[model samples]
Target: METTQHRVVATGHADWAGTSTQYQYIGPDQNKHAERVSWKGHAEAVRRFITDLLKQKPPALTDLSHLAAVGHRVVHGGDYTTAIQITPDVRSRIEQLRTLAPLHNPPSLETLAAAEAELPNLPHIATFDTAFHSTLPPKAYTYPIPMKWTRDWGIRRFGFHGLSHAYCSNQATNMLDRPRDELRLVICHLGHGCSAAAVQGGRCLDTTMGFTPLDGLMMATRSGSIDPGILEYVQNNHGLSAEQVGHSLNHDSGLLGVSEISGDLRQLEEAANDGHELAQLAIGIYVHRIRQAIGALTVTLGGIDALIFTAGVGENSSGIRRLICSDLECLGLELDTEANTACQPDADIATKSSRGRILVIATREDLTMVREIQAIIDLSSQGPGGVPQVTVSKSNDKLPGISNS
Candidate 1:
């Protein structure tokens, strides 16, 4: 029997001017191939990329018909608690979430539409980055705002990067040789988009990102948490409208805003090494905010069993990790300076004498999405008695592990 497995992974990014699509596939011989293209339109580019990939007749991926199923990494799923098949209604619901995730959902929808049109016969699944944080308690999710806004606007902390958090949590448990239910962890996902998560018993206790991706730790170009009063103050003083302020915060702020230079951390670090005051200040602010979040989330977990660093910066930048873990002896977390500077992925950089484990794990959100899609498919295929049944309701009352409040 042939044991080789075939799969395709595709991604579409909507940049300032246009869109780009990248696709990868594994052939029957177990060799891998990839291709990328940049074009003007998002949906059209995606369609063209897939069409071109098929024309090349990749070993295992001859065409869209060869795929068993398509799994999409949806940035926001709103109220959905699990991965679901992308039906017409589901697509519409995803479209409705655009306003909440202006930078993410639109590009996702464009790619999704292109894929559906190109491969109508294949089953498509939407695995949400927000779904894993659905386990957050009310205290963690609720904003201390007016009752009218809370009740009428559905405004609350909906954490982002949940897929990365979940993946890191699972990997951390495995690395620690402990059952996930018994471990409490603090996961720092640092990348272009950054956030922290406190996970207890495989469930999210709290996370840094709240309501929107813009509300978390400072990111590459996006400003992290900022005072709402600052917005109003700037509007009154600078004659900037609400929309213009939002644009600046989301695009022109963060490291770029503070450094008055490039947003790339590598660039900032180089400039800082040369005694650039603002560059050094930008790096300091970034490290300071991350360390602060770690302390807060450690308290949220009551104590931490393991501290993990994942994602791009977390996995690669040992200097950044060292900076964030500095002066943490009080929390029983110590980094082995030698191991950290080695820049090895999936390694324990904690000192032998350190009480708490400091680990660096490479995050695989794509694997998480694939597992979720497979789980949904497996559940649907089970016999009537094989899977437990539950009543479905429109009200939030039926959600598990969450209070109606």
Candidate 2:
């Protein structure tokens, strides 16, 4: 998130594992505050941090009474389409879904408990990463698996990076001065975990990710889509168990496995510059997958209007963007070398004659969460009649309660 003492905001910025806590600082001059603490330890940390900060002269919050509400970012909302206030049943359901996002939701649950204890009077809202993708139609979300599995197991494409995709896609609309529904956009979120989403008319048509976050793009450590037969073959031939296979796929694969070096792309790029073949291959695969995904998404949208890139690699890696956009001219996209090389995000970096826009947008999940939280709060405060009542399903797996503080 943010630097502990400096308040440089890194809220809603998640690592591969969701263990950090970032929130509104109970301090004056609070620009952005972040900490990586979790569980009972995380809860205790929040209580201590808040108590100590509020103890300052003329206190930042004038005690807890000045606080409005608490908002949390969840990584995998399976069914919920929007932000919801936390309740006991809701908290329990979130806990149950931990098996799906073991790395993230556990810490989020801990942080939630901690926040609840520390701020008992406040309403805590859960904003989901999967919330924005609830618009995926059946064809896009459905797996070609058995119908029984689909009906009983809730096995469908549950795309993620919703906050980032929602933020960037809307930003694309704003930058182009067009209404969202009027444009066909492909938003690529390239980070520790990557996914590409197809958004049209402010609705997600399809996304690369599926039942789990691990299903889509090649990430820093996780392998993207692969032949499931490989797992069976490894088990049937080798002595590795299913767990071992899963572990390797999730942790030992992707860039790290291919490059046989660091998972960080910067390191891979350096190695590639030094004539490392595998490093070159890793970069090649990464770019190819992105290009392929963009083409498919463009087709899904009927045509391309803008290809927006956001998140870590998308926002900063000019070379990666250039390589991915190089031969994509067939899709009516063209990268401007000069503009791309020195481009700062929230700007277009496409050639003037390119039929589709090439944009780099710095995603702000924190701001997305804020807007959603504020919307819920505004709805709730409109007296009893203004509050919207909706049912929350404890059905199957769902969002991880990642603490963005």
Candidate with best TM-score = 1
Tell me each candidate's TM-score: 0.86, 0.85
lDDT by residue for model 1 over 162-195, one digit each (tens)?
A: 8889999888888889888889899999987789
Question: After aligning candidate 1 to the native by TM-score, how far in Å is the CA of 238 from where it should be?
Answer: 1.8
Q: Which window of ten consecutive residues has the lowest lDDT sum in model 1? A: 396-405
Clashes of 1: 0
Q: Considering only N, C-alpha and C atoms within 3 Å, which residue pairs clash in candidate 1?
A: none
Cα error of candidate 2 at position 326, Å = 0.9
| Candidate 1 off by > 4 Å | 1-38, 52-58, 378-405
Report the Cα lDDT for candidate 1.
0.74
Candidate 2 lDDT over residue span 110-164, tens digit each: 7777778877877888988888989999998889999999999888888988988
